[model samples]
Target: MMDRTDRHCRYFLRQISARTLLYTEMVTSQAILHGDLEKLLGFTPEESLIALQVGGDDPARLAKCATIAAEFGYDEINLNVGCPSQRVQSGNFGACLMMEPERVADCVAAMRSASNLPVTVKHRIGVDDHDHYEHLRQFVEIVAAAGCQRFTVHARKAWLKGLSPKENRDVPPLRYADVYRLKQEFPDLVIEINGGILTLDATLEHLAQVDAVMIGRAAYDNPYLLAEADRRIFREAVAVRSRHEIVEAMYPYID
Candidate 1:
């Protein structure tokens, strides 16, 4: 959600569902450390239940980024290990890091210790020929041991060799069963499944098997999909606001 879930988009979504958790586009740890912090990390208090997602391989820089994120009032810090973009791969992070569980462990531990905030990881099930249950389990165990209790898995193995990033999202068959099995084995950890989930009903169905569901393109493509999220997903009794009211509400923010 690099350019998709920006502050403006989040504010729009907030007017729809106050309870839905939102995340920032992945900001590089180096960017947070040296770039314009406000532009990179700024968000409104109204955007509660929000998380800051960072991408990088340096444990020290990520740890620093975590501390900065906490000070900026983010509810969670998410490490990206699921993205298959060539840009991310060249940086030595993203889906490629699945091959280095211990290194991921070190980065997680460093971030956790730095901010003392809730740390989560988003990763694919596997990479290259390493797509196996044991491979996923080992990766999860190592990171979990480093105190990352929550993992958002993009239920597909990332093919780093031939597939382009766009193809990656569609090419690799979604092995949701693999994610379901993960939740079964590690019942104590929070396992949230991602990848192609498009409806509130589908989200609810996945919740029956896992702890949570993360919707990306689906939600962004048709944000009205979130209008009933509070009442339907969170079970809040608040009245559902109409589309006209939402559009009127967003006019000022859009300006």
Candidate 2:
């Protein structure tokens, strides 16, 4: 769970599923390097599987922050190259970074070399008006060659100048077909699809086409949906817990 604005949500979620992976809201590299590192990423270890989502174009700063995240005991480190926020764009990161695959590759390589934990990337298909399957293919190709194998693609293009971040997630149409094709082209790579995947059925459908499905809004809104997620998708032997029971189970730990 990343990009969420509420700390209450994180506390509630940690109460629900200790086995599920969790992510912090995207923190810029400058925040980690120049700002307060302890305050930005501080959390309890019992918050389940945690990953830090970083935003920045500078490779050295990004790597240094990744090392800090590792020292903070983050299970994995993810780079956010998919956000369409104008503020993020002005910072020369986010969706705009997708236009520079070589730079993204270098950023990933630096992060990977800095820490022992897994380095992953979450990106958009394309940015602004440059929406094309080939463009996404090239971006993935170069990044994969740079030693970052895990990718989560938001199946949409980001119109940098027009859409607001909220509108970017909704207004622009989602193009899931391109993501499926990318998976077919790079079967060796671990490909996960994001954007507009709301229901368990939708995730199932996408999983048939890609290696994994990443849920954001849906997972946060209808959290009960995850009741069936682990058993069905991850093939865990544990039975799905009722949402009410999940809450109760987590209450004691959080208290």
Candidate 3:
């Protein structure tokens, strides 16, 4: 979701579904440590229930960033291990970390110790030839032991060698069953499924197997789909907003 789920995009989505948890784009630990803190981390109070996603391999730097995110009022601190971009691979983080579960566990442990807020992780099912359920289970088991309770699994394996980030997202056939099996084995863990979940009905179907479902590209492209989220997902007894009402609501901000 890098460069996609910015403040403006999140604000627009928030207007559609007040109850869906919003996450910030993956901010690198280097940016959090050296960049403008306000510009990188700031958000309106209206964007509450937001999780700040950070990308890095260094435990100390990640811990510092997590502390800063907590101070900046993020409800959750999420570690990103799903990104497959070459830029991310060069940094020795992202999907490549799937091969090093102990290191990821250390990063998670450090962040949890540094921040009082909930610490979570977003990762892919596998990487390259390691697309097996046991591999993913082991990765989760090691990380979960480090006080990390929640995991968001993108139900696709990452191809680190040949595919581009965009290609990795589409070419790798989605194996949602792997995610569902992960939840069955680790019933104590909060497993949320991601990747290719386009509609609310599809999301609800995934939710039947996992604890939650995350909609990324679909949500951003067809944001109005979230208009019914409050009623359908949260079970709120509220009226759904019309597309016209939503546009009207954004007028003041747009102007």
lDDT against the true structure, each candidate: 0.94, 0.85, 0.93
Q: For model 2, what is the error of residue 86's alpha carbon versus the real structure, in angstroms, after optimal superposition?
A: 1.1
Residue lDDT tens for model 2, 107-193: 999999999989989999898767889899999999999888889999989888878888989988899999999999999999999
Candidate 3 per-residue C-alpha lDDT over 171-232 given as tens digits, one digit per residue, 9 for 90 to 100: 99899999999899999999999999899999888889999989999988999989999999
Number of the top candidate by lDDT? 1
Model 3 per-residue lDDT at 54? 93
- With a 3 Å backbone cut-off (N, CA, C), the pairs that clash in candidate 3 are none
How many angstroms is residue 123 displaced in model 3 relative to the true structure, after the best TM-score fit? 0.6
Alpha carbon deviation, residue 137, candidate 1 (Å): 0.6
Give the better candidate number (2 or 3) by lDDT: 3
Overall local distance difference test of candidate 1: 0.94
> Candidate 2 — number of clashing residue pairs?
0
Clashing pairs in 2: none
Q: Give candidate 1's error at residue 32 in angstroms.
A: 0.9
Q: Which ten residues in a row have the lowest lDDT in candidate 2?
A: 1-10
Better of 1 and 3 by lDDT: 1
* lDDT of model 2 at position 87: 91
